[model samples]
Target: MSQTGYQSFEELIVWKKARELKNELFQLGKAFPPEEKYRLTDQLIRSSRSINAQIAEGHGKRTNKDKIKYCTQARGSISETINHLIDAFDCGYISTEQLKRYRIRFDELEKILSGYIKYLRSLPGD
Candidate 1:
């Protein structure tokens, strides 16, 4: 792919951060007991991974509105990941410090995703 201007969704900073978030989420879920393997752990993994998958889908869309719709899904997935992380902390599966660090990462991803959505909305002809 050409590097003229973020030729692919993988070139996006938000996607990269979201990917990192997914990895951290996997590590976090791995620490949970076997009982959670198919419950909280699975939700955490799926939601975190959804953030990037939706963003990539959005980037391939042909219209600003379509992109906005999919990015909105990405944003929702980010929120879902945050909620699951909070549950993890509340259930004592992860440390408070770990939750804080993960929160910071997701917060940054949220801000960037929000800004990107705004930019897409502001595009000519919508």
Candidate 2:
């Protein structure tokens, strides 16, 4: 079991939210121009997916410090994903409204992820 009382990262609300965001981003990437197949689209999908993967990896760690480290990495991935989203907007792949919507979702995910990290920190272990 995880320090947060969850049996698996899949059971964590933060991970679920990240998964949802990742899925949505994957769908959005499918709409990108063919020429961007190896550029923006690839980077966007990779970073968005990394958020959930990092959370899952963190949850599996044996130490609180390791867990916190991975969660921090996940947080960084969130920022990276947002940067890619902005790039998509600047390149006209997505509209202002689309970018705004994604920003809201990313913001919510970041808050939840931060809370999870705080909870992990409160646990009585290294």
Candidate 3:
């Protein structure tokens, strides 16, 4: 659907993907061992969710610079999420299939976000 009157990043494709990634990460956390419930699992889930949260917050800003700043933060959160996912995989908390799914989703989100960033840069402001 057209995002024409949608003033926030919550209505954007990348944000939706990030939100879905957060949900999946939460579900993935549930499969982890009980000992990790409050440790790596929690951290991973939080980081995943934060990415979209930052994007929404950024979109609320009136200026493109501020929006890009928040978008950068969101991207950083994505990196953190990817790192945590790698840690989970190395620790054997998730299977290869699960890792593949996360990577694929992250990649798509990254592309959308990157495109948005480029668009913002092309705006009148530096």
Candidate 4:
């Protein structure tokens, strides 16, 4: 919890954005018909949230390599989420507007994650 020597990337910007995406995901899934509760709904929410959780886990690892690995996993989770979101749009589980919104956020995060990974890879003693 100490701020000493902590990286700026650990600030609330990324976490806040990810948290907002997770909330929107929850709302969108909740709007789905009850029949989907244990199916697409659950899957979508789980995958969406995993992206955020994995990033934080990676940060907590404190090793550049380990952090990069978790960020890679998070990127994979985001890809899976994008597919699910597309499916949700196709199935009318979500609006095209909602999909667009989530897509934009996901894309932004992807770029950030990619940059972080590249930066990590470029570090000495990796």
Candidate 5:
């Protein structure tokens, strides 16, 4: 139905992985200090969610070019999320181990997203 042959972005492995990471980050945000409720926690949750949101939005686009654009935005969200994670670490909200674990997961997601973008670029014109 879509350019990728998938029925929905939800069916994409990259999107699924992004969703998993978003959920994990959401849980992690819950433990943040109440004082940070409007700051770091909010930013972390929003950026993590953006990755999947962009993917889903891109999947609905009619052109491969549009899809690639959205995926690129999702990649940007990934970077923003990692930066927030680093801030959490600096603030002592998360341990170095937790930060490293998230970094690895995000790295994998970035690679997968890059692959998806490459595949899109290989497709014929819109």
Candidate 6:
């Protein structure tokens, strides 16, 4: 979509991707053992959801600095989610195939976020 068309967070590619990733993670989380319902499951869910939450929150911040800060936090959340995925793999909660696919998703989200951050930084009036 064009920048002019971006009226809300829903119009953002990064936000959309993060939302999709969250859904995919939710589905995959279902396969984890029941014992992790409150542990790993919750952690994965929260981190994945935070990706988009940060973006939306950042967009609404009062200043560019605050917005950038929130965007950076969102980027960190993606990394955190990746670590959680690694832990899930180490614990045998997810298969190698699932881990690989999920890692790719996170990688894409990170790239989009990075680009968005760059765009934000390039804007005038810092």
lDDT of 5 by residue, 1-126 (tens): 589765777879999999999998899999999999999999999999999999999999999999999999999999999999999999999999999999999999999999999999999987
Score each candidate by Cα lDDT: 0.92, 0.95, 0.87, 0.83, 0.96, 0.90
Q: Residue-wise lDDT of candidate 3 within 2-121, one digit each (tens)?
A: 567554566688888888889988898998999999999999988998898888888888899999999999989989999999999999988899888888889889888989988888
Per-prediction TM-score to the true structure, in the order listed: 0.94, 0.94, 0.90, 0.86, 0.95, 0.92
Model 1, 32-78: lDDT tens per residue? Answer: 99999999999999999999999999999999999999999999998
Cα deviation of 109, candidate 1, in Å: 0.5
Per-residue alpha-carbon lDDT of model 2 for 1-126, expressed as tens digits? 679765888888999999998999999999999999999999999999999999999999999999999999999999999999999999999999999999999999999999999999999987
**Could you arrange the candidates by TM-score from highest to lowest?**
5, 2, 1, 6, 3, 4
**Number of clashes in model 2?**
0
The weakest ten consecutive residues by lDDT in model 1 span 1-10
Best by TM-score: 5
Stretches off by above 4 angstroms in model 1 are: 1-6
Model 5 — which ten-residue stretch has the worst lDDT? 1-10
Error of 4 at 24 (Å): 1.0
Q: How does model 2 score by TM-score?
A: 0.94
**Which residue pairs in model 6 clash with each other?**
none
Which portions of model 5 show Cα errors greater than 4 Å? 1-6
Report the candidate with higher lDDT, 1 versus 5.
Answer: 5
The residue pairs that clash in candidate 1, if any, are: none
